[model samples]
Structures are given as C-alpha cells and as structure tokens.
Target: MKKDVILELAQRLRQAGISGEVVDPEAADGLSDLDEAYAVEGATRSLALGAGERLIGYKIGLTSQPARDAFDAKEPAVGHLLAGRQLEEGRPVPVAGLFQPKVEVEIAFILGEALPGPHVTAEDVRRATVAIAPAFEIVGSRWRGGARSLPMLVADNTNAAWISVGARTEALPRDMGSTAATLSVGERTIAGSGTAVMGDPAEAVAWLAGHLLRSGSRLEAGDVVMSGTLCPPTDIKAGDHLVAEVGGLGRIVLDVV
Candidate 1:
C-alpha cells in the first residue's frame, strides 16, 4: 500500500471513530493483501499517536471458534490497543463515543518481561505474565457492512475500541483452560470458559508472540495482552450494566452510558 493511501485510511478511521459513522474501507483499493492490511493498521496507530493516544498493548481476535465461524477465518487476527481506550474498573463508557459497540468477556495478561518469539509456548507466556485480570473488550467497526472478512477487519484494528479491565490478581490459575466465565447483562446471561479461546488463554498470547516475531517485533514488559473473547460478543445499549465474572480471577463490570 502506498503511504498516502495508508494515511488516508487512518484519517477516515479517525473521523469515523469520533463521529460514530461507519465506512467501507474496502472501497479504497490495495487493502486486500494481508501484509498491506497490516500496513494500514500501523498507519492508523501512527495517526492515533499523532492525535495523542498512547500505545499500550495488543489484542488477539477471532481465536474463539464462534468468532472464527463468524468471520470465516482459519486463524486469529491481531490489532493495536491504545492507552486512551483503556477504561478503569467499574467506570461508565459513553456510548456516544463509539459506533455500534459490543462487549466480550476475556482474560488479559500484563507482561512482566519482554517476550520475543518464533517458537514461544504457553508456559513462556505464563512465566512472563506478572498479573491477570478479567476483562471486557468493547468492539466496534468503522466498516459499514454488518459482517466482515479477515483482511477488512485487520485493516480496521479488528474492530477494537475500549478494553474495560477489572482488578488485577497475582494468583494466576493453575489450569486456565478450565477457568469458567459468566457474562451477565441485567437478567440475560452467557457462559463459557478459557478453553473456548484456543484451548488456553496463554496459548493465545503465545500465538500472538510468534505472529509478531514474523514482523520482527516482540511483546514488551508492561504490555497488556488481551486474549480472545470467551464467547460471541453481545451488543450493548445505553443504560446497560454488563458484568463478566471469571472463576478465580474476579469480575469486571462495564456500564454503557
């Protein structure tokens, strides 16, 4: 992709983000290739930084079977997470700042040490992780269409907006794959487990580390990595209070305003 086109897409995304308007980025040419899509993502990150958003971490998406099924993808997609988009525990997120927001329950890792990987394992992620938290990933799309393809989603930061994190815990579970999760909004509920995310949440981090290695990058200390969602994302509305409880990891609450 040309640098000009990349910058153009970044401006489009930035405008869409602020106005809560959806755009069809595919309408722009040369975003079909995987590498080109990632280039566009990088340009968007640069644009966000220029607007004063801090780079905090990364997120893995489509690792859940349901998400993969929804996007017709065989593997996970990765995207940038900005510090400005991170929410404090129990805070209300203004719905007006987002476009078609939805929420998903997840387990997030705060790395204690840098991890550079081509062959990183789950145990590697476990050793590097200093703390864990129950999290809610607030997802939205700049894309105008209802459903999306991998390349299109990749170029749009995998539909990420804000990540609502609960309190951190040092007592990491022994078997994360077996960790249970329950997401509740008012009376409606959805249940899943860590295993729904690539067998183990650590494995998802490991996968991300290895994937980043392909681009000559690494996961650094203090980086917060969000593993994939435990279940399909739930559409949120104003005045909704959503709670996600991860067994042994405590709970996170997100209030949509």
Candidate 2:
C-alpha cells in the first residue's frame, strides 16, 4: 500500500474512534496484506500518540486455533493498548463512547523482565512474569458492519477498546493451561480454560514477544500483556454487570452504563 493511503486510512480510523461512528469498510481496501495492515496500525498508533494517548502495552488477538483458522491466519494478530482506554475496576463503562462493544475474559501477564525474543518460549514468559490477573477486554470495531477482512481487522487495531483489569497476584499457577475461568453476566455464565488460548496463555505471550521483536520492539519489564480471551466474546449492553473469576487468580468486576 502507498504511504499516503496508509496515513489516510489511519486518519479515518482515528476520526471514527473519536466520533464513535463506524468508518466505511472501503477505507481499508488499499490494504493488501498483513504487512500493509500493520503499517496502517502503526500509522494509527502514531496518530494517537500525537494526540496525547500513551501506549501502555499490547493485546494478542486470535490466539485460538479456531479463530486463526477462521481468518486464514497462521498466528495471532497484535494490537497496541493505550492508557486512555483502560477502564477502572468497579467503575461504570460508558457505552455511549464505544462502538459495538463486546467483552471477553483473559489472563493478563505483567512482565518483570523484558522479553526481547527471537527464541523466547512459554517458560521464558513465565520466568519473566511478575504477576497475573483476571481481565476484561471490551473490544469494539470502528469499521462498518465490523471488519470485512482479516487485514481490515488488523488495520483497525484488532478491535481494541476498553480494558478493565482485576487484582493481581505474584503466585503463578501450577499449570496455566489447566487454569479455568468463568464469565457471568446476570444469570448467564460461560466457562473456559487457559487451554483455549493457544493451548496456554504464556505461549501466546511468547509469540507476542517474537512478534514484537520482528518489529524492532520488545516486551518491556512493566508492560502488561493480555494473553487473549479464554472464551468467545459476549455481547454487552448498558446496565450489564459482568464478573469473571479465574481459578487461582482473582475476579474482575465490570459495570456497563
């Protein structure tokens, strides 16, 4: 894709995020591949940074094989997380500011050491972690009718939105892949295990480390990485109170308004 076209799409995405209005899917038509998509994502991130939004960390998307297969992707996609988009625990999330938001439960890893990887492994991720927490990722899309293609989705920052994190603990699970989690919204409850995320959330983090390294970036010591959702995303509405409990980890509470 042309540099000018990438910047133009980035501007469209930025405007859509600010106005809470969906952008035309055609706006990303110029994106030809994942590389181009990431170019647009970087451009979009630059625009946000210029506007005073701080990059806090990164989020991994499509960590499950099913999700990867659906998108014809061989690996997970990455997105930047901004500090301004973090939702406070126990605070009401304003629905009016979001566009078609949905929630997913995830295991979050707070790094204690930088993982500058070309050969990082899941065990490396575990050894470098300082804490783990149950988390709620409120994903929203700024593209009309959602993203029409994988590249389009990537260009839109993998549907990044609000992230509300729960309490953290330094004690790591004996078997992260076996760790379980349950998400509840009122009387409805959905269950999933860490195995759902690339068989192990730590492995997802490992992949993230390599992914970042390829872009000349690395997982910093203080960075928080959302290892991807354990279960399918559930639609959320105003007045919805959601709770997620991770086995051996704490619980997360999010109220939508």
TM-score of each: 0.95, 0.97
Residue 72 lDDT in candidate 2: 89
Q: For residues 43-156, could you state the per-residue lDDT of candidate 1 as single tens digits?
A: 888888998989889999998877788878888999999998898766788766565788989999999999986789999999999999999998888878632577778888
The top-ranked prediction according to lDDT is 2
lDDT per residue (tens digit) for residues 1-257 in model 2: 88999999999998888888889887776778999999999999999999999988999999988888888888899999999988875777776656678899999899999998699999999999999999999988988888878998899999998898889999998679999889999888999889989899999999999999998899999999999999788889998999998899978898988
Decoy 1 TM-score against native: 0.95
lDDT of residue 143 for candidate 1: 78
Candidate 2: C-alpha RMSD to true structure equals: 1.1
lDDT computed for candidate 2: 0.90
Q: RMSD, model 1, all Cα superposed?
A: 1.5
Residue 44, model 2: Cα distance from true site in angstroms? 1.1
Lowest lDDT block of 10, candidate 1:
24-33
